[model samples]
Target: MDYGIVSLRSNGMFAFLPLGQRVISKLVALIDEEMRSISAQKLSLPLLTSGHLWKITGRWDTTGQELIKVQDRHNKDYVLSPTHEESVTNLVSEVYPLSHRQLPLRLYQTTSKFRDEMKPRFGLLRCKEFLMKDLYTFDDSEEAAVVTYNEICNAYDRVFQRIGVPYLKVAGDCGNIGGNFSHEYHYQAAIGEDTLLLCNACGISTNSQLVANPDDVSCTKCGNQLTKVTGIEVGHTFLLGTKYSESLDAHYQNEKGKPELLQMGCYGLGVSRIMAAVVEVLSQDEYITWPWILAPFKVCLITPKKGSKEEGAKPWVDHLAEYISCMQGFQNDVIVDDRDKLTIGKRVTEAKKTGYPLIIVVGKRACETVPLFEVIDSRSNKVQVLSHKLLLNYLKEVSIEQ
Candidate 1:
């Protein structure tokens, strides 16, 4: 609210202001790049899906009220998508007869989803409407699907590792999704609602809900002592095998030219939930931090304070901003706080709270003979005064190092 990142919009919904939208856009770009690296094809699905498809998958009745069910003018039932397993499987069934040569096919989409939460709270963490990235894979056999599963898990780990956050992947139950194998990716945070049981002896992590008897907790792998930890779930991958494909008759032609159910897997990444969870994990007392790749702007160039002695430095500040914006890492990702009406102190404080990684000040130093600028590295809270040539080189070096 203070920095105009987001505006309140009813319960469980947020209106992303200019700054917030910029961060979301950068996050999407990073996710898309990773997906493409895995040879996943991007596509979109409708928000409203026919209840008939859900019924075929046996989830229409089992999903209960949490699934947002509705009806149209002709009295045909429909549902607002919580996930796309049923819809995606139904679509693939029509395009059947995939040859053995095209063994693995991956399709994915990033889109808005709807779920009826009993109580919506904690901003985007548990929301009625939010954005998500879901990928579905079809393989010729269970052996092949298992290989793809490991590859997808590795890709997921890379995403979090690049963000420079501490995260863990733990075994999870299939529950309503109805898969024999499952894993969840989480960021450890104090506000996390889910409890994880970790075994030190065998280095195993299991979801607390999966513990059938809390009084007798032990690692399923090594029969060792387990301790509890809290974590916010950011992503989940399910090795669904033939669950959806068999139910929906989604199949491919085998080497013998016989129809066989396609081995399938589904993976989900909560975009909005990760955004909220990252802030919860990285924010410090009075100041926020962001993943380097997800920051709204790489640098915030602050002009002289209103009516200050350095008012004559306007031209130099503008010139500096122009140069930084064209730099390799910046690529026009730098912004100038030209609101000269506000005090320089106030603007710098605002930029710090808003999580700009770098802040450059054009004050008294800018009016000096050599025209030195004050550079503040907000990420490390370090300050330095350097000449024009040195300042540019310093920023360029920082980008390369990252």
Candidate 2:
């Protein structure tokens, strides 16, 4: 479903087709649910901000050519935000009068981010523009900030687990967004661009960039043998204690009525990149092994005999579609493929390419007495003939689990 789901607009930009957008929508919904569970409020920030705001953090110069710079109609300079640290800091400083009581506030946004990548490849992995879920936390003290950091880490762990993808949390460098400490969650994929070394003895993982001696085959911390793993970075969390808060003048008053800088941390998840990374790791050939939860449509109803003057085959297909479509939980999640113009074989092939979790093809026998439907499990490549009631029951059970 490469081009069918994703269409490349330019060298580094892509537009998500309907099916691709559905996957993205589901991913975003999952992220929002987890963020809300942590009491994080969702907000929207402008896509373009004045360059002067970035200059306050000194990233305007340090970010180099990756920053997308533009000019306003009145000649004012602005940059497409690669992140929202400076913007969020400014917003908090202006809106939330800083107080110790207001400390440990978490705010997040899911928005489009821009970075002029020199080489954008591997679909959405390194695109110039992509969707991101970035969260910022403010606190009163460094000690309290670290606690909040751990909480966020736990929340991230829950998210990755819910996604059902294998990942590793390893020490990472805070390159452009400067911070004292950070951790990156990498999803194991053969096509990944980053290399990580995992300790065989202790389960500790380290990014190759932080390893002092790359040629060494042992973990420096445990002196145990290490195995190299290649993975795509999907999430990163940073403990930015007063970095942007102090620089951006986000000051809060302590209990003693003394002005203090807000301790801060930031977490980022590449929303669109997660979709692409999942595709890279879970898909084979043209079939995408969508985690049941992430599938665009849980079930597809194929009417191979549409427009035919057969023994009520098309009518049977319609009746089945209506029955499945009206099911309690799968109202909008079922697709009725009534395109009879295409041959039955071609329709089934196209549906398989879309990677629906379940494909139900209603053939001529479906109109006969004691009807049975052919159900295809896209991931296992297994076909089963089952009664209509059994197929519906199975779909509902799977949907409820997701």
The reply for model 2, stretches above 4 Å from the true place, is 1-3, 174-180, 307-311, 326-331, 400-402
True lDDT of residue 71, candidate 1: 99
Model 2, span 1-402: residue lDDT tens: 374678999998999998889989989998899998889999999999889999888999999999999998899989999999999999888854577987679999999999999998888999999999999998888899889999999999998998897789998876665544799999898888889999979888878887778768797678898899898999999998877888898888888888888899999999899888887888888777777777888788888564654436666677777787778766677888877777767777777778888888877667667888888887777898878788778778766876
User: Which pairs of residues have clashing backbones in candidate 1?
Assistant: none
TM-score of each: 0.95, 0.95
Best by TM-score: 1
Q: Which portions of model 1 miss their true places by more than 4 Å? A: 176-180
Model 2: what TM-score? 0.95
lDDT of each: 0.87, 0.85
Local lDDT at 252 for model 2: 85
